[model samples]
Target: MRKRLLTEVEGVVAAPVERVWRALLDDRPAYEMTTELGDHTVAYQGGWWYRGEWSVTAHPEGARVVLRVYNVADRLGWGVPLANRFFVGFGARTRQTFAEGLTALGERLGCPSRLLP
Candidate 1:
């Protein structure tokens, strides 16, 4: 039951943290992709192998959003890597998707946003 790290990406929003937080609450992702919601974090646990979590934190410019994927398999955890090997560029694709999401969120919030390196 180890929550192994998979990949992580981050973005910065040029708006108040509260505004960003409220927007996250008002606009959640697809229901099937979500497993937990908290004051500053949203988590998605899919099947028995994958978990993606997003969190927001105060930043000097405004707020910072981070998305982290994990290997949360309850069994056959060793196969997670073997299975993922077939999905080449999975981490890159995940980062790109998260960056696009941040851009879209910025657009919706009428603020500037940029993905972190």
Candidate 2:
């Protein structure tokens, strides 16, 4: 039996879509991309086990990033959904992690992005 957590949060970037994409995604050609957090590619656009589904879309004068992290589990008969709810800390941490990542991405790209609360 196993369990996982999934959290969904969105933030706005005050830079052009292309620029934001390049910065956060290392200039990947497609919207589907992976994030390198040290040696682990824990974040991805397409979703993975215990990982996250990361998406980027263009908005007026900027872009928006959406993250959904989840996993399948058997911790109980209730499965991953119940586990996720019980572990609220994971969601909070995920939010902060993504927020920081977005901020760092903007800095690395040389175009600052404002994270919408």
- On TM-score, the leading prediction is 1
Each model's C-alpha lDDT? 0.87, 0.62
Mind sharing the TM-score for model 2? 0.62
Best by lDDT: 1
> By summed lDDT, which 10 consecutive residues of candidate 1 come out lowest?
26-35
**Residue 86 lDDT (model 1):** 93
The sequence of per-residue lDDT tens digits that candidate 2 reaches over residues 74-94 is 334355555556777877888
- Model 1 local distance difference test score: 0.87
